[model samples]
Target: MNETIIRPNPSIVYMIFQLKTNQPSSKLIYSIGPNGVFPDTQGMLQQHSDAISTVIDYSQGETSEVSYLKLRRSHGVINMTSWSILMIMGYIIARHFKKWDPIWFYLHASIQTISFVAGTAGILIGYALSKKVDANVNNHKNIAIIILVLGILQVFAIILRPKPESKLRKYWNWYHHYIGRILIIFAIANTIYGLSLAKEGSKWFLAYGISIAILVIITIILEVRMWIVARRKTQSTNNSSHPQSLEFAYQT
Candidate 1:
């Protein structure tokens, strides 16, 4: 019997059953660690995970290095899109498009949700890739985990957002803004760390660097424009009120 199985990444429970039978009792369900052969953190890469379960026993000792290398590269690419592109895009929408009102909120939420989901997937893949490689990734892994936790908090904060006129709204705004800014900082730092570890290529690094530079430039321009617009509106209001002041003086 075929069962449609859907689960989160790195699910802990494991089930074993004969394919030809529809008996639930026959299935043996148990808890499982990363690989069938459980190991400590330092020995994680030594275990034969499903992704790189096979190894050559020949004298040359050529194993699954190629596959794991490709997996590492794929992990890097996923994080690049997730943290670098989607997260930054969400931030831009929320910060720069306030004039869009509620529409900006929706776009920001959607983009951030996607970014969080993608980032989760990237970290999971990174963990799985870790089981297949020997490079030290403790710091990178810790930073990514922190990012995940912060992302969850951000989601909850959105869900529990206070109304504009609420007394607590200002505090909420501060928490949201500062936490988001910190999250972005960590995400960028982790991405740079991953890139350096991957050592993919100079061209890839150049492209990522260029993209970041462009984003910074755009943000600066929009920020200046916001200042200019606010100042012009303030000046216009002052100029319009000067005639009223003169009229009041004449009447007096």
Candidate 2:
């Protein structure tokens, strides 16, 4: 067995620390070098003044929440995955797969529900980051709050949806459609705003922009094709019915 002790130099002062100010076990010790900076590469240092002498380095990595930057990134990625990618895909399926009928409707509902859940998770992460850093993200935070509210409205809209035969169904449709679009718009914008503030880089921002553009183009083409198919069906049905009406009149 062996022991070595390094007592704090009482004359040393003006040391700064980061992360945890103290390791939760005991008192703190600090050191300053000739440049008035902490000798550690992080430019800060923390030491327990009363720590027991130990030759074994048994300290563990952080067991608390993940790093600040990782949390920020997760927030962006989650919301983008849910609202921008999955939610838009749901809209496309419903719009272009009209012949799928109840199946398409079910798929649409299921996907949007999952999207809301993921977006909600992202919202929680964003809130945590806000409290952790507490700076310069007002625009992103405000937009997120709006999106969350809209998400709740959409959820209630589904729950309170009118029956197909109900007189108010058309108005419900209008409300649901418009609000969903607005929520998607805000979610996408907030994601971009977050990317801009992110310290990592611009690659994610570029990728997301390209993806949303592709979705928009696909939506346009599908919308046009849907209308064309609907018009053809209506004309075919009209033409097929006239001969039966003429035949009945002649028999009478």
Candidate 3:
């Protein structure tokens, strides 16, 4: 009888999938089987594939804490949300007071400054992660860059705005308001899309939905309060300027 021996080539024998970040060693999930025996283990390998698919499918519909990697993926979303909240607060205060609020201005400046720093960090991480993640790099990355550039320009405008008493002040105000609004819209849209790409869970979606709802309520309240105040001021001024008009109407 002749002696028989077997040697399996690991690479050809097994099928393994791994996630690789640019930073470190890739993590492998599982291996199929030894070379010739792999055909014998087909049933077991199919089972493994099915189990993995089931887990991923379940995760897609679940609400759960985001993984550290997913959070890293959502860096741009976090940055833009922070920036938008600050802008919303600033706009409410400025519009309600009919003049710039120093506190609002300072807060806006601080938030934008922080956002700029965070956005830079995000860009660094995103560039590294983009190469690995299965995402549309062109649309996602290019739009994000445009939003950031616009945000920077808006900050510069805030810093270089004309004095309130200057002849160009009104024009500057319009420019500031329009540009700020445009940046905010872009930020919100990008944030929502980024949230969708967050970990396989519903938490990101819930967080985003709640944020938008709260902001809408706050904005409506602010608008109503400003309108009421403006109406009262107009009534008082009219009463003083034309007191006889009311008296004459009452007599008739």
Best by lDDT: 1
Query: Once superposed on the true structure, which residue ranges of model 1 sit more than 4 Å away at CA?
Result: 1-66
Q: What lDDT would each prediction earn against the true structure? A: 0.77, 0.76, 0.62
In what order do the candidates fall by TM-score, top score first?
A: 1, 2, 3
- Residue pairs whose backbone atoms clash in candidate 3: none
TM-score of each: 0.72, 0.68, 0.64
Model 3: what TM-score? 0.64
Backbone clashes counted, model 2: 0
lDDT score of model 2? Answer: 0.76
Q: For all the candidates, what are their Cα RMSDs to the real structure?
A: 13.1, 10.3, 11.5
User: Model 3 over residues 135-190: C-alpha lDDT tens digits?
Assistant: 34566677678777877787788779898899998989888888777877776776
58: Cα error in model 2, Å: 15
